[model samples]
Target: MTFDSLGNLYGTTYEGGGEKSEGGGTVYKLSPGSSGWTETVVDHFLPTGQYGVAPLGEVSFDPHGNLYSTTSLGALGVGTVLEISVNGQSRIFSFDRVDGAVPAAGVLVDARTKTLYGTTTGNIYNHGNVFRIAASGQETVLYDFCQQPNCTDGSAPFSGLISDEAGNLYGTTEFGGANGLGVVFEVTP
Candidate 1:
């Protein structure tokens, strides 16, 4: 769960919805009311939609207050990057092996530019990649794992990224350092 600038709490559940509703999951909002905190289901990911299901990360907001996140699984057999707003929910990007697949991390929105950065756990490399998707639907692969012949650089980034003032990104890989252990890496986009 994460809080917006307004102090409202937002999150997704891997389960729960109305009777007869497909069990993809639900997006919830908790508002601070005079009595206490009240919860509301803002949206539901039904198992039947062309869209995705099985969200597994914290929600993050862009500068304009739209929320962004990823689901671990979806109907297409690949996960997705989803955006939510008062207007409703939308799928910003769908994962496919050519570009990338299986996002293990949620999105990190550049508050100033609205570009999104995240990691995918599979690719032709079978190691993973770091990618950037713009609000305009363009996806850029910033780094492909196992770039080094033996993947000495790193592999399978299973977490989100941190941005520096100079426009650099830092993240961790689940495996592949000089010693075949996990590693922390920095990339400039």
Candidate 2:
């Protein structure tokens, strides 16, 4: 699902309303109603692996009203990020390891530069990396962890990051810090 400009919500449920996981998914819309709020299931998964498995990530809308998101499992266990248009048209983006395999979090789009950034659960150099996936789908490693003694700079950033108005990126570590209880830090471009 995706978010409209006014903050109304839309999303999907992979299973449970009927035949379990094989029945595909359900597209839903959540919006403020006069008395309260309402939910509508707009579509359902088709039981074909090509359409995807559970929808496990956040959804974002492009300026042209196309919705985009990824599922943790689908299309051969490697996962996929797909685009769903307002006319109900959907297609996979042909994502693979070069885009930082297994993205476990949502993508952050840099508004000014139109760059897409996300982190992965996969590891390189014994730890995960912060990655930037450009509009052209070329991904670059911005930082790799466990490079320092005691990893004072932080390690294993499990969640993704956000950049402030000044263009500083902020994120957290699941391990390795002053006291090892986890820490939140920022990076400057």
Candidate 3:
């Protein structure tokens, strides 16, 4: 979960909100009230649709207060990057399997550039990748993991990303390094 400037905490659930059979998941907000804390369902992911389901990470907010995250399923059965704003929720990008698939984490928003970055756990190469979504919604694979021999560069990034002031991205993989035990990596993006 992440705290907005207003101190409201935001996050997502991997399941719930939709029909019991569907269990598409939901985004929610927690606000600290005078007496106690209040919880509100921000967005309910559809049980069946072209949109995504099973959100697996915390929600991120851009400078404009627009929320962003990824789903582990839907949109051709791969996954999607989504946005929630005053205009309502929308899928900003979908994984096609070739470029990447299964984003197991949320996105990192560059408040200044309005760009989003995240990692996928699988791709055509089955090694995962780091991607960039431009403010205009164009998706680019910034770095494909396991590019080096023996995948010493790491593979299967199953977490979100963090950036330094210099704009370098850092995250971890679930497996595939020198010892086949996963790795923490950095990307220039």
Candidate 4:
């Protein structure tokens, strides 16, 4: 889910609508209706192998009002980052997995830098990784898990991240940490 600059709410669903898995997901906008709340599915995920399936996680918006999110299992068996235009045009960020795989978190786009940050569940290691997807679609790994004892730093970020004004990222771990009770971490760019 996400909030726009004017505080409008938007979101995407992974599954469970009338169109079934073939429909993939729905991009929605939320607003206050006369009765209470109203939601509209701005776009429906097409049943195509090229487009990723089951979009998941919180959403983010670009300055132009495009929304972004990720999918886990997709037509390629990897994953994808997608942009939904305010007018409802869908565009794939389009990065192949030489860099990583199976993205499970919403993208954090640093609009000032035109760079995007995300995490992926990789093929070789289920441990997952944080990666950078450039505006030009070049992908790079920022961190990988060793999967040893304490995980030393932290492991498996299952949610979206928050960045400070200084360009530092703060997030949580779902598993594998010092006390095995999960962890909170700061990543400096």
Q: lDDT winner among the candidates? A: 3
Clashes of 2: 2
Residue 59 miss distance in model 3 (angstroms): 0.8
Task: Write down the lDDT of every candidate, Cα atoms only.
Answer: 0.83, 0.62, 0.91, 0.71
Tens digits of lDDT, candidate 4, 89-139: 455554456556777778898988768887765535666677777777677
Best candidate (score: TM-score): 3
**How do these models rank on TM-score, best leading?**
3, 1, 4, 2
TM-score of each: 0.88, 0.71, 0.95, 0.85
lDDT per residue (tens digit) for residues 1-189 in model 1: 889877899888876664665678777889998999999888878776766887776788887788887876785567888888888878888887777888877888998888999988887767888899987978899999998867888998888888899989999999998888878999899
Q: After superposition, how far is residue 126 of candidate 2 from its true place, in Å?
A: 6.3
TM-score of 4: 0.85
Look at candidate 2 and give me any clashing residue pairs: 24-45, 25-45
Give Cα distance to truth, residue 47, candidate 2, Å.
6.9
Tens digit per residue, CA lDDT, model 2, 103-174 = 555566675555666565445344555676566655677766556778776776667678888877788777
- Candidate 4 Cα outliers beyond 4 Å, as residue runs: 17-21, 47-49, 87-98, 147-150
* Candidate 4 residue-wise lDDT at 87: 61
